[model samples]
Target: MTVTSAASEPGDRRGAFLLLGAIILVWGINWPVMKVGLGSIPPFWFGGLRLLLGSISLFLVAAFRGRLTLPALADWPVVATVGLVQMAGFLALVNIALLHVPAGRSAVLCYTTPLWVAPGAALFLGETLSRRKLAGLALGLAGLLILFEPGSFDWSNRPLLLGNAFLLGAALLWALTILHIRGHRWHGSALDLAPWQQLTGALPLLAVAFLVEGGPDAIDWKWSTLLVLAYNGPIASGFAYWAAVAVTRRLPALTSSLAFLAVPVMGLTASAVALGEHPQPALLLGFLLILIGLVLVEYKPRKPAA
Candidate 1:
């Protein structure tokens, strides 16, 4: 995936930074929230329900912000790409993969989308990959390796292997979405397009959920379950997705992607606290490398020629 901004440098770096932080927090915590949810709900149903809630909440928020509108015809391709590939395809695979893989591992694997995006951006979008950015990418990937703790990932187990494969597939879809987003000529704010994208993704998600999981009778909707589902909805999916799109649009793709590496670290820490899955000592080093990488990636971004 490419790290270049296909558009001009964002005028509002502060706002984009804040939104990026929000996205990281919501999605990082969602790792464990989802782990808990899947214990009681089937994967397909759980994914669909959460996305449906996301779409409704997003529409309300967009309307409240006076940004709600039908997507422009030019934006429809982006909408479909993000909605179907990023939201539905990625979430569905992640949810199913989470059934077999640990949440921390899943986060680490799925966030590897940047590895594919960096080269892609240079090739397809003509974004320059500076030496600093490339180094940051390498260090960040190293951190991911440490967090993943490859030795522990049971390559021999069929289910676990397949789950890992699913995560990589999700990452690919996400990379494609990112590339499309960077290259797209937007006619509206991320807020304006967010609800439509959610609606697009939600339709297929719900349809697939109904087909695969049958009726929702299998769901055990206890108080804990309801809370988990709610967190996954408006907070994690709707708001996080909106914020993520905003961040991607505003920041250098490399900068945003490297910063996003922080999510799995947060997820790892959160998983430890929420799920009682303690991190290995090596993961502490991984955390340091990732942050350093983020700093390096954002260091001295080139200014446009006057």
Candidate 2:
């Protein structure tokens, strides 16, 4: 498969890795930053505000590059659907979940998108579902069970349970979005439509915030809160989203997903350092299992010469 991207040089694995590393770092740190932002704002409004800002930032870049134009009419449906599912749905659900779950643990659960994507690709796109990948899936499930079992998480804690469930839902929605992107026959460059999609997704969220949460003034914007929003919007959502999409386009789905696993690991570390979240035994065990599973899924053995 050829990966055609503005940033990609032909046969450039090193460039891809560098891009992936930057994404993991930005996104990983953004987890704790998001938690901090939510401390000062409600979930829906926080998401809306970030998207709105990010969209504007991205539009500026697009316009500067002379690439800002309306999406072709035929592409609007795909853009709208992707905007809703990927930006609005995924962010809203994850933000709600973060209200209950700690940032590190939330990151871990949310990245389980790959487990769904691998199978979905096989079923719908005719990608190979090899035995290694199945084993990896089993291992990842074992990790989830270890993380979520009654022995690990107190079932009596309703918020935690609900939060975890929401994260899982977000992961599934994200997986669906991935499949959609993979299948989309782009009428224009995906990069060109990215800001528009972000803008489109932000509209409903802003509407909901006004209708349900009262209005934009509801946000009690501390300087720290404003700072986090700046980081989340321009760096995380704007640059990071585009970088991620570019990197994913340049790699295989499973490989892209596996590389994304770094986000949670960095999130975990950042949460521990920045948010002072303690790691639990079950979380450690689950993290290890999930890491192993990802490695298995991405591993490709070489054939010997005859």
Candidate 3:
């Protein structure tokens, strides 16, 4: 009998990298699209509807592929927990933040997931905090502080302050979700679990959206809005999230997480190009620090075999 390995082959690694790159690119461009779309749609409404569409699409795909399996009852609670923290909490906050902050600024803040993850992993996940990771965490926080001061904190208005707080809450929840998922036993690919989580979590969001936005009748249709929904729902959530899970299975968690550093940088650049937002020098510096931190976090020391 021939034996098969679960580890990805060299060819598979290359494909994973390509898929990861595409995910980053699509998500990068999506930042500006979301900002533009939120101009017309309420933030909660937009997030709820987008997630609803993504859940339906992903569930249909999972059903068709015959790979769908229900999580054990024990697993369902964790799944729901993660869904609320990562999907609902994070998405709603970011969506709301977009209304107050520039897309690029909001993207940078949200992508600070790594900063939170390092500590969370160390404390909760029992992952050893290496010197490199600690340094990287410091560097990332420094960068974030630079970005956060004056710019992110300048909430001259009440909505802006609420938005900023919401974004921070989202980031914290997302970091917690990541830690939980990594520590727990989830029996399928992100493709498999994502649909269930989204479908279930979306129920609350749908209610909130209706309560806040006052129903579908209040939504105005625009071509840009439709484009945002399609991109964020199908391409970004469906495809990008799946690609991330696939890559994480192949690469070390730290390595895959480091790749996320590209998301904010790409988002910032895309915003400048697409939305005509000018880059500030401090923001550029912050981006540099973030990149440096990512590099440090992913740096692996070679082990000599005995």
The model with the greatest lDDT is 2
- Candidate 2 regions exceeding 4 Å error are 1-8, 11-17, 246-257, 300-306
Ranking, TM-score, top scorer first? 2, 3, 1
Q: Candidate 2 lDDT, tens digit per residue, 26-62?
A: 9999889999889888888988888888889989999
Q: What is the lDDT of residue 27 in candidate 3?
A: 85
RMSD of 2: 3.1
lDDT of 1 by residue, 104-213 (tens): 77777777676666667788999888898799788977886786568886667888889878998998898888889878888866667777777787788788877878
Computed on alpha carbons, the lDDT of every model, listed in order, comes to 0.79, 0.83, 0.76
What TM-score quantifies how close candidate 2 is to the native fold? Answer: 0.90
Per-residue lDDT for 260-297 in model 3, tens only? 67888899999999999997878888868877876776
Off by over 4 Å in 3: 1-11, 151-156, 252-254
TM-score of each: 0.82, 0.90, 0.90
By lDDT rank, best first, the candidates go 2, 1, 3
lDDT of 3 at 278: 90
